[model samples]
Target chain A: MFMAGNVINIFKKELRTYFTTPIAYIVIAIFLVLTGWFFFSTFFLFGQTELRSFFTLLPIIFSFVIPAVTMRLFSEEFNIGSYEILVTLPVSLNEIVLGKFLAGTVFVAMMLVPTLSYAICVGFLGQLDWGPVVGGYLGALLLGAAFTAVGLFASSLTKNQIIAFIIGMIVCFTLTMVDKVLFFLPESMLGFFQFLGADYHFQNTAKGILDSRDIIYFLSATFIALYMASLRIQEKQ
Target chain B: MIEISDLTRYYGDLRALDHISLSIKRGEILGLLGPNGAGKTTLLRILTGYLAPTSGAVTAMGFSIDEKPLEIKKFIGYLPEEAPLYKDMLVYDYLNYVAAVRGITRERKTRRIRELTDICGLSEIMHRSIHELSKGYKQRVGLAHAMMSDPEILILDEPTSGLDPNQIVEIRDIIKVIGKEKTVILSTHILSEVEATCDRVVIINKGRIVADGSTAELKQSSELEYALNITLKGAEGQDVKTLLSPVEGIKEVRELGATNGELAFRLVCDTAKDIRDEVYGKIKQRDWILLEFTQEYKSLEKIFRELTKES
Candidate 1:
């Protein structure tokens, strides 16, 4: 069907808008700076040569940076009254949402590219195990996909970009922080709360244990959030 | 061809369009005339498949809007009143994107874009960002985008709302040129625009069609008469009124004033009658000096007011 064409067209336009603006550069700059700090504090000061510290801090970094890259995906269109034009096109709602999601995912992928330098530096410094490094990259991709989906859902809920950013940050932070907070909860409720946390699955995948359940969990969250974004768009119309 | 029957839309408790029904013939330029909040935008949105009607059905080119929305959307190009556009994109890029989404291939996209740019008088601003354009140019860009796919039916909601006088004339001319090949339905409060560009007029009020006919037929149906102002030197008010009252189709008469011993009287006559000859003969026989006489035709404004003022 021609839905593929619509998705590709929308993806190209959205991606171009993101890169031409200053938001993409700002996001990538901040991500690199934070990762550089983590690298220096762990490797140069503590005299460690492993990437475990770097992979450990990625979910926290992505919680903020992913939303920064995706907060304007739909909210800016609504603010400028361009959503009406987008929805009236012959394309279905699924194609539009998927196109925007893919654009946000590509932006996240670009942000992750510079961090490869950190991985390379760590690899050369020590006799590294490439298997766990590969698993860390996969985990980062899954986490970024999940965060971008949540950010897009938040973007669809409001026309104010600041509010969208704040909401996305809050949602992503909750998903990431719930695991540690569950330690203080009742024993019976810890399992339920840990099931809602992204860090649990991300930690498992970071150690080169590619659990099929963790993959399914991340994918299901991405699908449900994007589905909600499409529904929100319909409500807006 | 477009056919709508019992089409109605409600936003919660308020009825935006109330049982509206109409049909548009092929190659017709129909004007939807109404005041503010007259449901013009709602009706246009429903017809363009942007919004679903709460009740009833609309069939465009024999495709039902509810059952075959994608098919209906393929044939229609809609420009909302706000002219929704991406301000950050250049005109060429944005239109090419629209063309692609509308299924225009890359092989013919450039030629179609150039043709639309020239048709809408947007060739000069094709390379500029949309944010840098003025309101008139932005409206033209919206029109050009709508014309990108060469749709069979074009729905424009107040396409010439914010332009100056000269720009309005230019845009109206372009629309006139476009209407030769495609069906257009434009909504506006400017009645003269309806008279100038529309082959048929659909006057709406309170979500209902008050009157639907040609411009001349609507003017005739409003019972609007022509007024003749006459100034004579030797005639009194009673004499002029009695002479004009006895004429065949004079409806009423009123005296304006007497200036410098000359009498001025206004005669209201059915527009169907040409009483200038009768008045000339009567004044000639009376030996009155015929100083000034002018006939004023009924404008579309009066017809609009008369049609919308009723329930």
Candidate 2:
């Protein structure tokens, strides 16, 4: 069915579109500047060399950043009516969803790769923990993938990109806050509810623990969200 | 090549397409004529597999739309009403993207793109961004996008809409050329477009098809009447319309007279009744000299207006 070819075509087009606009560059530049400033400020102040603080700040930063990256995945096409053109093409819904998901995740990775110099700088100053650095990046990449899936689903719900971004933020924030917010739930239900939180698994991976359970959680979350997004597209057709 | 049976579509609670059925052979350029909200787009969306009918069946190239949308989509090309395009992409890149999605191999993609640029007259502005192009060129690019796969069926919704007269003619010429090798179904409210390009027409109003035939057949079969143009000699000073306005079956009389002692009058006659003989008798009785009397041809416009206005 040429499914792989369809995904590649869609990915190429999506990636090309990202580079064609100034927004991608602006987003990437802001990401590097902020991450660099925050990392160096903490490093110089504490007189220590570690990326732990930077890793801790990343989840909070990406709560807004990842949604911005993925907000237009489906929303812009729907707004401009180009989704009509896409659906009319011979490609299946799975191909479109997967292609767009990867495109957004790749853009986030492109932004993340430049920040590796921050790790190098830490290594130059003092003894650095390579384990946590690798683990933090893996966690960041996994979280970016999950956030992209959530953002893709939110974008499908509306043609307005701003609304899509807001929806993505709300959904992702809820997933992160689920573990922290135990006020309404009974004490007995806290552990089970904490397990459902997106941040709960990422904490272990961000600490370089490399837990299979955490990896499985991110993969399954991404799969489920993308599956939901595909369902929306199918119902539209 | 296509068969639609008892097709009905509902948009929420409102029925947008109501029990429509038709068959189309390969290589026929069919025109869909309808007013706004007449379900022309809806019907086309169904045919292209962009939409699903509420309760009916459509089979194109032996594949049902509901059962095998991707297979049928592989055979058909559809251009939506606005010709929605990525305005930022260069025209060449956009077409290439479409070609890639259509699974056109690299070797053939290059040759196919060259062929399309030539066919669509897009060579001059191939490197320009889509936003920089004029509306006419945008439509040409959209046409190329639809044709990139060399599809067997093309469903264009308002293919010639929102263009100047010259651009309309250009697009019409393109459609005429493409019609030779492909089965084209274009929808428009402009009867002249249908007259100029379509081999067959289906006029739909309120989601129901009212007329289906070739241009000449629809014009001839339509109950729309024609006008009788009269030129009178030696009756320049007289009010010819006043004299002939009272004739039966003549709904309205319009006069076009010159100061050189010649009068010309046109009469809108009822198709159900013959009024020419009565008008001649009245002219003779009134001693109004008649030089020429002729009936105009029944135009497609007349047929469309009459058919749409009737039910």
Judged by whole-model lDDT over C-alpha atoms, candidate 1 comes out at 0.87
Question: Each model's TM-score?
Answer: 0.94, 0.91
Please, what are the lDDT tens digits per residue for candidate 2 over residues B231-296?
A: 887774345667777777888887866646667777888877777788888788766677789998
Instruction: Provide the overall lDDT of each model, using Cα atoms, as 2-decimal numbers.
Output: 0.87, 0.88
Deviation (Å) of A70 in candidate 1: 1.9
Off by over 4 Å in 2: B235-259, B265-294
Question: What is the C-alpha lDDT profile of model 2 across A1-237, one tens digit per residue?
Answer: 438888988998898899999879988988888888887777788886778878877876787888888899899999888888899999888899999998999998999999998889779889998998899899999998999999999999899999999999988888887888877899999988888888888888888899898999999999999989999988986
Q: Write the per-residue lDDT of candidate 1 for residues B57-152, one digit (tens) a residue.
A: 999999998777788888888888869799889998899899999999889988898888877888889889999999999999998878778889
- TM-score for chain B in model 1: 0.93
Worst 10 residues of 1 chain B by lDDT: B302-311
- The window of 10 residues in a row where model 2 chain B has the poorest summed lDDT is B234-243
Q: What ranges in model 1 sit over 4 Å off?
A: B231-236, B257-264, B271-274, B289-294
Model 2 TM-score (2 dp): 0.91
Candidate 2, residue B163: how far the Cα is off, in Å? 1.6
Chain B TM, every candidate:
0.93, 0.84
